[model samples]
Target: MKFRRWCRNCNCEQEVAPIMGYEDSWRKLFWLLEFLRTEETIAEATFDEYMEHLMFFGKLAFDADDEIEKRLKEEEVSDND
Candidate 1:
């Protein structure tokens, strides 16, 4: 199976053939979190701004899933009609 990488910053997509192993991918994700945690500066505000960004991204992801489901349901209804 082939995997694809999407760059949100560059708006580019490329297919990666013979993707890395599952364990490697998991490790990469862990490393990425660690890097973000250590490298990104968190302001000394009342709340953790970093966490706010994470929550925002999480909400966006959930919203996208909800939208996809809604569109699929609408399509199904239209097809039945």
Candidate 2:
């Protein structure tokens, strides 16, 4: 399925295609989430652990723009030297 993502450089939403060649991985993840949703005996600790992991990944995604900008600035400095 096609998705739309905000393009900071263009200041507009752009259509994005799913990354190629990861269908099996995506399917596995989908199945895992489905299982979790349907399972009635999930442990509290397991749910908390998964939440922590999700938050960590979310932080990485949110910080990506700043990381890219920092790297670009570092590259510029090195190029000048």
Candidate 3:
């Protein structure tokens, strides 16, 4: 599924796909969405600004690790069922 985030320039939410050459980071994008949910500045920051933030500091969240762990747990549960 495509990921969604707020865009200050569009003055509404926007969808984004995995960036070229970084398809593995789609999970990170999901993490970014969850990260943005509680953030206050994205509402004031333009889409480019957001991209810049992603480019520079996106990997700090470690959400992908949590997501992977959760999925593995789900697989284990399904296997047991």
Candidate 4:
């Protein structure tokens, strides 16, 4: 799957592919989000950099949710068959 994301560093639109295996993907996203939050809370990165990371993480979360939903729907259909 493809997702359009705004790149703050390059100041352009970039295409992203998110990993989609339910548990594995969620774990990956959870770690990424935790790292971002910790960095921001500790002021480890500059303001611009922190915001950029937040945006990227948010986009990933959105894609992850979409992937989970798609997988569930597919399973439902298969079960009904």
Give lDDT for model 1.
0.54
Best by lDDT: 3
lDDT of 3 by residue, 44-73 (tens): 567677677776555554666678889999
- In candidate 3, which residue pairs get closer than 3 Å at backbone N, Cα or C atoms, i.e. clash? none
Q: List the candidate 4 regions with Cα displacement exceeding 4 Å.
A: 1-43
Q: Against the true structure, what is each candidate's TM-score? A: 0.46, 0.32, 0.32, 0.48
Q: lDDT per residue, candidate 1, 10-80, as tens digits?
A: 84765544424434543444333333443334323234665575666566656877999999999999999
After TM-score superposition, what is the CA distance of residue 45 in candidate 2 from its true location, in Å? 6.9
Clashing pairs in 2: none
Q: lDDT per residue, candidate 2, 1-81, as tens digits?
A: 654554436646665554442455444343344334334533233767666645654566558758898999999999999
What overall lDDT, based on C-alpha atoms, would model 4 receive against the true structure?
A: 0.62
Task: Report the C-alpha lDDT of model 4 over 1-81, residue by residue, as the tens digit.
Answer: 655554547746665554453356446664454444444453467667666766777788788889999999999999999
Q: Cα miss at 44, model 2 (Å)?
A: 10
lDDT of model 3, residue 3:
65
- The CA lDDT of each predicted structure is 0.54, 0.54, 0.63, 0.62
Worst 10 residues of 3 by lDDT: 17-26
